[model samples]
Target: MEAHLRVRAALLLSVLALLSLLARSSSQEIQIVNAERRIDLTSHIVKVFLTLKVENIGASPASEILLAFPPTLIDRLALVKAAATVGKRKKKSYLPLDVNPTELPDAPNGTKYFSISLLNPLSAGESATLEVLYILTHSLEPFPAEISQSESQLVYYRDSAIILSPYHIKQQTTFFKTPSTKLESFTKVEPTNRAGTDLKYGPYENHPPYSFSPIIVHFENNNPFAVVEELVREVEISHWGSLQITEHYILKHAGARHKGVFSRVEYQSKPSFSGVPSFKSLLARLPPRVHSVYYRDEIGNISSSHLRTDPRKSELEIEPRYPLFGGWKASFVIGYGLPLQDFLFESPDGRRYLNFSFGCPLVETVVDKLTIKVVLPEGSKDPSAVVPCSVEQHLETKYSYLDIVGRTVVVLEKINVVPEHNSPFQVYYNFNPIFMLAEPLMLVSVFFLLFIASVAYLHVDPSIRK
Candidate 1:
């Protein structure tokens, strides 16, 4: 009996060992041929682009690829787009891609993953290129975090100098582009180069997968980093004559807050105080042929606002009631009018259509949340809209002057929007001609009935006695 039990145990151990060997041999590995990372810090927003060449080296096909970021950046990161292209195609057509976050057991704190699925499974020995674009919000930190009003501001940014990948990297390069050429300080790596406002790092070779090298950059950026916490843009169409646009903004200064009370006398007397970090005014470029421009804040009209118009373009310059220091908040509204001929169209089928476009705010900044509402004429129907960014849409009705039926309102909401989203949003809708003339026809009928009633009353005269 003992001999039989020993034989059974030995057979089970041998089977388990064989299965382990098979699992190890069948495991697949991916190789990164080259990587390029570009970081642009021109405005208040920070943009990052990554491109990679990858190959599947295992026996089986690769259907998915995974990429991760440092735990610290997971909350501040917003993915803009991701795509992939198969081997060396000159025409440059990108494959459809879907990205989602995946949890990693190794990085327990927090790690964001970008998973991309290929249309055609990447067979063994086949290669493809992958590209990723994203934005970093509130990533710039003021080195001091609090500064006096008269001091020049210095901004610091920290990031990885190497590409983060799950596959072995054969070669890689990183480029950091700053807004100004006045770079104060940057970390020096063994293999790096620089020219003008661009700092380049490596064509590094033979790096194990999932490697990281941290870097910090300090530069002179005196520009006010304004962030619009929320913005509401409304467009009201008046088919009778013109189109009106109004925008309300909740703006905030994103730099370091003031440490002490501001001294107006000291600021005026010293030339050095001129370098204080505060937002005084903003310039907005309006569409051509706009009129009736107005700028005001919660307190009332801002008299410091000015409008400049030429044959070529129209500009509006507005000054806030007070200089916006760090952590300070302000709210304001700006409105203008344009002729209807610019946006209305009549189809050959006798269908009336209104097409309108709205662009981003004129201020060079980032908007965390934006809501745009377009109000169409009464009795409008079958409305449609197209916006370049991702948005949630809804429809509502609004009542205004002389309106028998409320106008159709289209509301669009977007999050984490940047200045590059300046692409105009186009909207189209149909209007009934009968509804357009309803108000005029009703007014005429009321007048005609009143005249007839007055004549009848006069014909029936009654005598009065004193």
Candidate 2:
């Protein structure tokens, strides 16, 4: 009988404990719902649907709803597409995808369901979804959204993947056949979902455009979105593994956050702008055994940047053109020397020739109209040179430097784009192994010929000339 009584007492205590736990968890069952997706190609934009799901623990709907918004993915998508739409960046007030980051410690009982999206900014409802739609463009997606009073913004591939292809680029009306300029051809684009996030790039079937797969670089990407209305990068490859690269950056603020006229005071006083680096300047890595680096631009000199290298680690660190702000502009230049041996590559048959031509990108502009010219090395002897692959619709020939007719020149022009030009242009040309060497050879040959002529002239006796 005593044993039975103990069992009954234990069961009573267990029941009481269960009731208390249930009371505590009664408010934790709130859920969010109403997720949607939308894409507008007419304007070139995308939007996401989000809603809150709240369950009434007290069996009663809440009196009000308070929702917190997050701006984490804003730069990667919606806002970026919107920036591509229209000619210029849409006013932030007019933009559909602007949202502030929100954190909710504990949701109160009076609040109910919330619907949010990039479209609708705010709504008033109890136990209902507050949906808002968002929009973005490529340039705005570049980060460091705003910098301190005086700082440069550094921008590059932050949230996506790269797809390279191997193909001889097109030049005006012909093709330049070469190996170095081949693209890492891409075929198809694939996207996968790993939870709430979707990824697009590759398990990579073959290569780029064909064999190459899209390379997605998703990270905390704190860099700012910037567009240099102008940029000039000159790379010189010389003897003894010496490579010299000069960067001239003319940058303008291209962030999606600019709402109205510029605010210099607010931008300058901001602590982040004063300390953090913007995407305006970048980190350049050179081959081994490089020394004597310089950074400058059209503005003469920028003191904000510095460079350092450790012989053991063999690394090159560089700073940017200017401190990036919400809607400001600046220009600067930089130069660094690298080893020539590192640049020398060998073919299957073992041949040597100087390869110095590379490429730049198409800067999406709403203003339209642009002129760009690429100056190749003096001895780029091939009669044909492959042009860069970009949004180029028309191209023309320009003659300059030294040539019988003129070095093959290509001019590309187009407008109304956001920021896809950040990629490199693939170009190739069959270098004249013999002719590329001829410039210096010809110079030496001329010098020797002149010397011999002088000697002959002196030895010929003035009497013979008379």
TM-scores of all predicted structures: 0.77, 0.37
Our model 1 lands, by Cα RMSD against the true structure, at 7.3
| Model 2 agreement with the true structure over 1-466: per-residue lDDT tens digits | 9999999999998987776554334323233322222222112122232222222334443333233222333334321212111132364233332333322223232222222223422222323333344344452233445434344332322222221111111110101111122122222234332222232232322222112222322122233444555554544433324556665555565542333444456545774654333344444444345567555656565565554556643343434543554566765655666665655454454433334333222222221223334333444433222333233533334454333343433343433223333333322334444555645666778899999999999888666453
- Scored by lDDT, the top model is 1
lDDT for residue 288 in candidate 1, whole number 0-100: 79
RMSD values for the candidates in order, in angstroms, are: 7.3, 25.6
Question: Runs in model 1 with CA error above 4 Å?
Answer: 1-30, 56-67, 70-75, 82-110, 115-132, 179-203, 263-273, 306-313, 345-359, 445-466
lDDT of 1 by residue, 350-387 (tens): 55555554445566777788888999888888887777
Give the worst 10-residue stretch by lDDT in candidate 1.
20-29
Q: What is the lDDT of residue 99 in candidate 1?
A: 71
**Weakest ten-residue segment in model 2 by summed lDDT:** 167-176
